[model samples]
Target chain A: MQASLFVSCIVDQFFPEVGESTVRVLRRLGVDVDFPPGQTCCGQPAFNSGFWNEAKPLARRLLRQLEGKEHVVVPSGSCASMLRVFYAELLRDEPAALHAAKELAPRVYELSEFIVDVLKVTDASEIGGRPRREPEKVTYHEGCHLRRELGAVTQARALIGSAPGAELVEMEQPDVCCGFGGLFSVKYPDISGAMLADKIDDIRRTGAGAVAACDSSCLMQIGGGLRAQGLPIRTVHLAQLLDEAATPG
Target chain B: MEATTKQFTQSAAKTLSDARIQDSLRGLYGGFSKARERAAEATPGWEEMRTRAQAVKSHTIANLDYYLEQVEARVTESGGNVFFAQDGEAASRYILDLAERESVKRVIKGKSMLSEEMDLNRLLAGAGVEVTETDLGEYLIQLAGDTPYHIIAPAIHMSKNRAAELLHRGVGAEGREWDTAELTAEARRQLRDKFIEADMGITGANFVVAETGTLVLVTNEGNGRMCTSMPRIHVAVMGMEKVAPTLEDMSMFLRLLTRSATGQRLSAYVTTVDGPRGPGDEDGPEQFHLVVVDNGRSRILADPHMREALNCIRCGACLNACPVYRKVGGHAYGWVYSGPIGAIVTPMLTNLPDSRDLPYASSLCGACREACPVRIDIPRMLLHLRRELAEGRNKNAPVAEAALMKVWRLSVSNSGTLAAANLIGRALRWPLLLLGRLLPPFSRWARYRELPRPVSPFRSRWKDIFRT
Candidate 1:
């Protein structure tokens, strides 16, 4: 089966390796993947900022680029949710595009959503370094958009559990937002930091070696605080782990 | 004062950081959040009730003008005077003139955010009218000379120990370590004399029923009833948006409000009073006046994205469910109305420059939407306000932020560059990784969190597998 891989802009610009890991993991599962070069963003920032007028053109352009695709997958839950929910709202004035938006939404899936529901690959990946360190106990911070909006929490954890030596532990209110709403961070830094501080404390309380989430933006925000404190705790996108699991040690 | 969003937030930040106030807000966030969650679970049709309640509020707000007239006519016929004050100054002036005419020197008040918005206590105090707050929370906050942090629980930021100290100092009973009951007794002993001696008692109405010309006041404390009935002259200051189309509509809201607010089957007191006391009535006000203050609601009513905010029941359920509020608490909002409703109202009611900063206070997590009884799309409103801030609609935001968003808006609109960047992202993976470590903001991002490192070219691998 052919799949269109959407390396969400956040992953593409800052964390290109996530894009590579997604492709490797998908290919290992025998899924044919194509990175549609025409894709840039899902137009979430504009849509979330209430610039429906500005976001609509981008949404239309996005819909047009991936128009004929049967399966489109993204590593980020928020970008997927934008396509699932806000894309249609943005294009409301253009009734002609409604069919395209509706048709594209269900077919648009997050990484775990695609792997578990579509690919159904449930084995561990034999990655490099002879396990590197000890069997690391990691907890997942379920990004709000992915968990609450996209309902990708369980699916994300299931994929994590498929990795060898990666014991996925559940953090309390794993779905609570880590205060990274794109512009919300810079706009209200104090409140954002305060909220992130709470999330970090919750993650630390679980005594997990690292925090993993599907959205790079959320990871970036949570990771910033954890890194600032110089804690042993690290943050990674789930795609990286699953890709590592797929490789031979 | 034309309070812009900036001033509101600055003041709020100052208040939130105050050690004494922050200590009090700990209970406000924890206690209410736990209580509301438990209440929702116990109520069988909690979700259904919320849906129905939202529908009712939406319908009333949509046809607000008709309901306002209906309520006015009913109140007048019931022997009560209904005055529509276009704004706060007008509302305060009307109340002050009424008091002057009635020779009212002493005034008592029940918990009312609307009165606080109008600064009625200050206005009445300036006129040499001694006004006393009847609710225990309101009384403490009043003595402290501060505005309420939370809408429902006025002194929610106050600790019992702090309250004991504030009361001991205010009432001239120095050095007395008072318990909760003792604190209540002190408030009662002091307010009792004012409640009886005062010529007028001012209270805020929970809802104004258009069908029966009735004003309902729901409270855990019985002070609302006493303040309304004990005085010879009664004046209820309510925001114009508080009107419901009918008694049934009022009933639907009351159930959702209390359950969502404090996890109670019903508040301890729900009093519905219409007009003056009848000849046979035992104890009630003889002259009743209801001042409907618009303040800035009419402007909010004009904005399609924001008008639903006026439907808020002042139930702080959204506050309890909000993660942001839980962390910083209500004082962070820096207004009489805090939590999700404050995020919407403070900016809408105040000018864009001063109050708009309050809207950016949320993470737009939509928890407020789930907890809202009227189902006010608070996250949506916050986003809209954010847009306004981004677009330079807010008079208070820094010019630098606006310029940056303009650049951001321009860059995202074009696909060719964005696509090129997408491909470049796969190509320049090494340098970008270095950039993430070296850059100031990126360093900030990496400090608490880690961005995933992409292994190889997503586009080229896909091309080899799919298109080939």
Candidate 2:
């Protein structure tokens, strides 16, 4: 089955490596992936901030861009949740857009959900290679929209557990938000920083070498906090981990 | 209490920096949530119970006028009087006038958020009538001359040492180190005398049963029973939305209310006061009054989008579940009610201009909605409030933020503009890296966390690396 990539704007502009790894992982799974060049964003930044009018045009553009694709995979859980859950509500007033959104929403999937649920690929060896180095201990941070909205809690963990050289060390309160709620990080930096402090402390207790999450926004927030505190915990995307496990160095 | 919601940002910053509040919150962060989870798990058909409770609230709110009239008629038939107060000032005035006419010198109060909303204690005290808070938490905060820091646990921000100090000052207790049991006994001893001397007692209704003409109050401390029974005159004040059509509906709500509020199947005392003492009754209030305070609830009930807020049972499960509330504590919200419910209700009940920042205080995490027993979509209402503020409904909208959103709308509307902006971002990546730490917008974000530098745009780099 052919799939279209919905590389989120944050991944496109701030973390291209995540997008590249997503494509590589999908290709290695023997699923034909196409990059829909017309994709810009899922309009979450606008929609989430209560700018439905501002978000509508982008939602329509996204619907039109991936209209006929059988599967639309996204690396960011927040963006995927926007397309899969919020698009219909955002365009509820316009009949045509609403109908298109209803049709398109169910087909969009977050990267881990796409791989485990749609592609049915879990074994690291089935996709490609063995571990090139020692197994790295890693913990997972469940993005709020991804875990709570999309119900993709176990899918990412399953993918990580199945990867060749990654050890999944569960952190406390894995389901708590990472406080990188897009504008929330900038709007209430004190509260956001406090929440991140709690999250980083939890990560420290696990003593994981790295932290992986499905959403780049969360990784960016977590990574930024870790760097600010001069902590050595590396932050990575789940796609990069899965790709790294599947490909030889 | 005067509203500090307008200064939510400053107050919230101060609350966040306060080590005492932080320590208090850390102790309370997940205790309620975990207990609630266990309680819900223990109860069979918990989800179904929540659904049924929501349905009951929706039905009652849809026919609120009819239910409230029924409550008044039934209450009057039971030899009780019912008064409708349009707002907080009206409610306080009516209660104070009653106190004056009845020559009530001492008044004892059970824990009542409605009383706090109406600022009734101060009004009564200003009228030269002695008033005492009977609930342990409320009494401690009263002695400390501070407002309640939480709805369920009023003195949650205070430590045992603080309580001991307050007791020593207020009730002339021996200056001795006290534990929880001893402090509670001292509070009981002090309040017990006030309860006997009190000529009038005031309490808030958890649910006002329309069919049975009953006021249902759930409390663990037994102060509710004391306030309702000991005084010659009894007054129960509640928001008009508290009326339930029947005792059966009240049962459904009772099932969820205590579980959500305190993670218990039932509170220690569930007092249902039907009316004044009957012909054969041994002990009860001689005169009963039910003051149903509308207090901007009618306005909220009229709007289709905001009507769901009236469905709140005020159990405060939302506050316990909110990460934001857990951090800043209740004082940051700057009102009687705090957390997600306060964020929505404060602005709607008062004026949006005064509480404009309250709605934006949340991260929109939806934890509050998940915890709400009635399933009030709090985040949805918060977003609605935000939209109203942005669309010029309130004059307090920040100009810079509005302009920034407008520019953002323009940039994200089309792929071409976004691509151009991405190109500019790439070209200025190094400069942003150097100056980002010192810039205005980045400075705000960098105050607590580092900003991620922009990498090569995917459009430009994907072709070279991945496409080949």
Candidate 3:
């Protein structure tokens, strides 16, 4: 099965390794991954900033890029949700673009959702490589759109749960937003920081060696906090986790 | 009640800096939010109930004129006067006029956000009526001369010690380290006499059942019962959108609202007040008046994108679930409502220009939507309001932000411009943060957390990675 990778702009610029990891994981799962290098963004920032009109041109552009793809896998849940939910809302008045959005939305899937649900990779051992001497204890952060928008809570957990090389531990209120609400981080840093502190508290209490998440936007916020506070815990994309497990290191 | 929504950020900073308010606000998540989660989890068909409630609200709001007319006719038929106030001022004026005409000496009240919207207590007290809030939380805040920090728990920001102090200073309580029980008892003692001596009892409606013009109130303290019964005159001030078509519709709402608000299978009191005391009635007011306030609801209803916000049942679930609300608490929103619902309603019901920051306060996390019993898409409405503000509906819309968005539109509208921007972004070590940290708003981003380290654009390396 072939799937086109909609490498989100965040992953494209700030974290290229996550894009590589996503590609590695997808290829290992026997899904032929293709990239449309022309892809720029899902227009979430402008869309989320309430500049729907400004978001429209980019959204229209992205729609044309993703046209005719069988399954479009995005590395970020917020971006995926932007394409699936906000795109339609933004482009509602434009008949052709809105029609394109409607067609593309059903095919759009977040990485983990595409992996477990679409690719049918139920157990992680199938892709997990060498068993670790010490199982990597990892906690997961549920991105708002990943869980709430896509409702794919179990897919990522299922993969991590069944992995032979990793142990999946739960954190309190993992589904709560990490406060990287696009421009919100910039506009109201104090409230966002306060929320991030709470989230970090939960992650710390879990005593996990690493935090895993499907969306890089969440990782940017989570990982940023973890680093600023000089915490030892590492942050990884689920694709990286899956790819590392599948690699015989 | 004035729109200090512009001060949301400053007020949020105040809440953040205060250790006590922070501690008090934490209960929203662990206490009320957890309880609501458990109740919904335990109840079968909870989702179905929410969907049904949304459907009911949608139909009711779409035909609000019809239902409201039915309410007026039925209320009149049952010997209750129905007055539709165009806004809070109109509502307050009508209510004050009635209080004046009746020569009301003392007035008792149940908890009502609508009353806060009307600024009723202050207005009535200014008119020389001794207005007393009967709900424990409302009474505490009333005594403290404080605005409500929450929708259901009006005095949620206050601690037991604060309550103790308020009771001592305001009502001559003799104790200091009073616990919740003692504080509640003290509140009851203070309000009990006012209930009987009051010439009028004014309350807010949870649902105004249009079929019979019945006002259903759900409360834990039974204050609703007293406020609707003992006084010679009973007056209910409600937002016009609070109407339900029938008792059955009200029942569905009751099932979801109490659970969503306080995690109760049922509130301690589910008081439904019809017009007034019948000839054979053992208890109830002799005269009843229903004051339906528009208060910019018609304006919100006028927008198709925003009308869903009218579905809110005032359960406060959205507040409990909102991460932003949990941090800033209610006072930050600077209005009767706070949290997610407050963010939307305050801007719409009041001035969007002054409350511009209110809509943008959230991270657009969608938690409020999940927590809503009627399933109000708060984030959606917030986005619409944001769009309205961004489109310069609000006079305070920043030209700089508008210009930046325009620049952003030019950049990402195509792959070519995007690549060029990414090239600059990549070479500049440019996560935008490195440059943004030099700026004001973006400066806040780096204060609490480090921005991501720079990396090469994925597009530049994708071809090389793909060949492998």
Candidate 4:
């Protein structure tokens, strides 16, 4: 099965490995991972900043890149959901794009969603981890975009459980936002910090060796908070974890 | 009068950051938030009810013109005068004209955000009429010479001490600092005289049911009843979207409104007045008038992404759940309505440039989404408004934020450049930490907290670490 990659702007620029891990995981699952180089942002920064006009052009560009695709998989649920749920809302006036968005939407899937739904991979071919390392307790942080927007919480948990030798521990309010809402962290750091503090505290209480999430933006935040507090917990993106689990054992 | 959102937010942030102000706001927000959580948990099928409430609102707003016309006809048939105001100026003019016709020297008012949007107090006061806010929270803030910081609790930003001081100044009765009860009594005494002598009374409606031509008001204080009934002339100002399709819908909303707003089974009073006095109604106003103000709602409705904002019940559960609101408080929103709902409503209701900063004031936490009984997709709307602001549709964002975002768009749009930038960003983390601590923009973020350094760049460190 062929699938086009929608490397979220954040992963495209700042964390290419997330994109790499995404590609590796898809390819390992017997899916032909195509990097549609023309892909850009999901236009959330513009949309979140209230620049629908500025975002509209970008949305058109993104829609143009992946039109008529059988499957378009995005690493970040929020960005993917932006195209799925809000593109039509944003481009409501432009009926052609709106129609295109609607056609493209049902096919667009978050990573876990594609893994479980489209790729239908029950087991991932992991490369590196064969002999299980010391079993580590890890907790999952459900990014609001994934849980609320994509409604992929159950799918994410299923993917996590599918990983080899990884114990899935639930933290409190896993769906709570880590408060790193793109520019929001920079704009309202005090409140953002307070919210992150609570999130890191929740992870610490779980005694997790790592905090896992799909979106790199949230990983940056939860990881940042864990580091700031000098907490021992490591932060891992779900793609990287799934990549670890997909190691050719 | 032409307060841009930036100017409003700055002033509001100033108020929020004040040590004394936060002290008061902390108590206000914390109590309401706790109460709301308990209430939400206690109510079975609360979440379902919220969704249903939102459905009703969405259905109502989709057919707003029809529902409003139904309300207008009903109100007219009930012997009440209905005036449709195109904007704030028109609404104020019509209300002011009523005051003039009544020779109103004073007007007793209930807590009405619509009036605040109209700046009715200032307008009426400027016209040489005394407009006394009778709700305790509103009265306290009025005496403090400020607008409400919260929709339900207007004086949510005021401490007991500040309330005492405002009461002392307004009442001119000196005594040892008194408790809340004593202070409330003083306000009651001061406002009671105005209620009796006022030539006119003005209110903001919670829901105007088309079936009955009835304006529903939910207030914890008995003050709204007095303001509605005591005067010879009563005028109710409402946003055009405040109309419900039917009384049955009003029943569902009233149940949802109070529960979501103050965590009350119902407010102390839920007054539904239909026009003026009936045959046996001796104390009711002789003349009742309903002024429906469109302001910018027509524009909002024309644009489908924004029209859902018109469905707001003004319960303020969204505000209470908003983390940004918890930090900055309502005053920081720089508009009459503050919080998630306010961010969406303010820009649409007022001139665009004036409320640009409002949409950015949130963390988009979605807590507000959870709290909203009518289930306004506030985070979605915030993003919508943010898009509007970024496209230079707003006049308020600083040149620097705009420029920075432009550069951000450029760099993030490309893979190779962004990857290189990320490497440099990873390398400069140490220096950026120092710069963030010392510089202007970064200093703002670093001021209250410590910056967390990046672990090695995700790409550079990926292979060996992941072992995949």
DockQ of each: 0.38, 0.61, 0.78, 0.28
Ranking by TM-score: 3, 2, 1, 4
Check candidate 3 and list the clashing pairs: A129-A245
DockQ winner between 1 and 2, please give it.
2
Residue B57's lDDT in candidate 3: 97
TM-score of chain B of each: 0.88, 0.96, 0.95, 0.91
Sort by DockQ, top down from the best: 3, 2, 1, 4
* DockQ of candidate 1 against the true complex: 0.38
Task: Evaluate residue B72 in candidate 4 and report its C-alpha lDDT on the 0 to 100 scale.
Answer: 86
Tens-digit per-residue lDDT, B1-468, candidate 4: 334466754665576457776565545445776677777789888888878888988988888888888888888887799999998899999988888887889899998988888888889889999888899998887888887888888887776777877877745444555688887787888887888898888989999998778999988878898888999988999988898878888988988888788788788999988888868877789899999998777998898778888888888887777656766777667677888887887787765666766777776767787777877788887776766666644545667887877776665554565566567777898888899888765676565345555444434433344334
In terms of lDDT, which candidate is strongest? 3
* Clash count in backbone of candidate 1: 33
List TM-score per model, in order.
Answer: 0.88, 0.96, 0.97, 0.82
Model 2 residue B79 distance off true place after TM-score fit, in angstroms = 1.8
Q: How large is the interface RMSD of each prediction?
A: 3.8, 1.6, 1.3, 3.9
Tens-digit lDDT track of model 3 for B1-468: 666887888899999999988888887888999999999999999999899889999999999999999999999999899999998999999988988898889999988999888888888878888888888888889878899998898888887888888876745544545779887787788777888799999999999999998899999989888989999999999999999999999999999998999899999999988799989989889999999999999988998998998988999999999999999999999998999999988878888888889989999889999999988888888888888887645545588887887887777766788777766765676646667777777677887788765566777788776855
Error of 3 at A245 (Å): 0.7
Off by over 4 Å in 1: A24-31, A49-56, A94-99, A115-136, A151-154, A157-168, A241-249, B1-4, B12-29, B170-178, B327-332, B392-399, B406-468
